[model samples]
Target: MKSKMLTVLFMFFTMYSGFSQDFQGKATYESKTQVNMDFGNRQIPEDRKKEIMERMKKANEKTYELVFNAKESLYEEDEKLEQPGGNSGRGRGFRAMGSAGGDLYKNIEDGRYLIKNELFGKIFLIEDDLEKLDWKLESDTKQIGKYTAYKAVAVKTVKRPNMQALFRRRNTDGKDGEGTKEKKVEEFIEKEVEIVAWYTPEIPINQGPADYWGLPGLILAVSDDVTTIVCSKITLNPKEKIEIKAPKKGKKVTQAEYDEISREKMKEMRENFRGGRGGGRGGARF
Candidate 1:
């Protein structure tokens, strides 16, 4: 038994050592977030609710590509052509509420990350140390494609927009405009949610899509409370090497600072919406 164990360890070490030299890989991910179409206490026609849900579904589903080496990775969304006559403005608003659309560069060896985020027509380079999650590795295993995957779970506290408030119908009776203003103060709130990730040792790279890393292998699938990001395809050591570089074209700020900026912007938009200065003739759509 000891000899067999030694042989397994030797093979793992050999594979890792081979990859450590000049390994580069590209992974494509499909991300989708489940939208709660429930508008609390809002009386809307069923047809209109269906239309809003469809728009939200389109905005929530996205594709991303991650280019990685031994210690560094760059994850960015795969661009798609906008459909003609599509509501681009409403789509953008929903996307802004969902996830950060940016070039995310992570350096696991150095414990740092840099994200080039464009929010509200302004660009920001969010530079900060990676927030390490206390992952509890599980013995569960499953097959993802040809690779065997192990599961890990963690609980994370994240700030999320109050979707109910955002979608709630405002009293147009002009009796409680002040109350609306006060409610906008809690546009975002912190909530704790569980994250589940499945990593495969076959790739033997401590990398994953987005800001996830520090596993024994490459992550094949990860899901949080609302969103699930899964690797659809992976290419290892392609003929053309992909460059993983941190983006440089933005005003630098820490993650906390950027969050504050985003929150303030959302607050301002909410105020504008309350004051009937938000959207076009139909008022804010979804």
Candidate 2:
């Protein structure tokens, strides 16, 4: 009887492992952000403004993919490389300005996450425990592709760039204003954004793009007024298994530390842009 029980337990364990592996898959998402073209003090010709608008449109529309299994997921932006001698559709009047999309990995079962961020040409690897979101699930349901998705809402405090404060006011306290000083000011405004997410329990995985997770299902669509991300395609149980790994390259830092570093860098960039300016006030102390 003991030998028989052992054999039965071994078979059950194998079946469960196979089931988990079979449910692994990949999802592709299309993201778009609605942004106002606010060029402060930077004047451009009307025709040039049109070109910049077109470029901004392409830049705001992005493609991302999430590869996941039963426990963990890796998310990153998918970029289309411009081949040599290929027309990029980008105008030559202005340089195409863009930052590297950060990579995020989350372990659902263990409540762990790793974020690899590149800000102002500096790399930072943020590794910390997952932040539990207080999501309010609703009874509303809709069809996303073939899956039935349910609605959920979360309030998140996010740091947004203040375009008006891009240029700092200079100090005029100088001997006949012969020399000037540049004042570093805070450029980020902290505010709450309502996040709406649609998830499907049929997938049986608690995963989503970016830093969103902990739903009873896999998130299919997420929007927060300004930005929206929707799943475009999904491939389940492909022939080759997806490899999920944490990002290891970059200066090691916590999430809070990284935020401080980012703010400091932005201040430096603002000061550098204005050349030589006078002292100003009204920036955050920390």
The local distance difference test score of each candidate is 0.76, 0.69
Q: Candidate 2 regions off by >4 Å?
A: 1-22, 83-100, 167-185, 276-286
Instruction: List candidate 1 segments past 4 Å from native.
Output: 1-14, 37-43, 87-91, 94-99, 169-185, 279-286
Q: Where does candidate 1 clash, by residue pair?
A: none
**Tens-digit per-residue lDDT, 165-233, candidate 2:** 554434445211225343334577777889999987767677887778877778999988578899989
- What lDDT score goes with residue 122 in model 1? 69
lDDT of 1: 0.76
Total backbone clashes of candidate 1, pairs 3 or more residues apart or in separate chains: 0
Candidate 2 lDDT trough over 10 residues, lowest sum: 91-100
User: In candidate 1, what are the lDDT values of residues 1-286, reduced to their tens digit?
Assistant: 4564344345546678777568899999999988875465456799999998998798778899999998899998887776898644322442242245788899888999998877755677888998898987776778887888888899988888766656444666643434543233376878899999998767878889878887778999999988899888999999997888889989999988878777766666655655556533433321
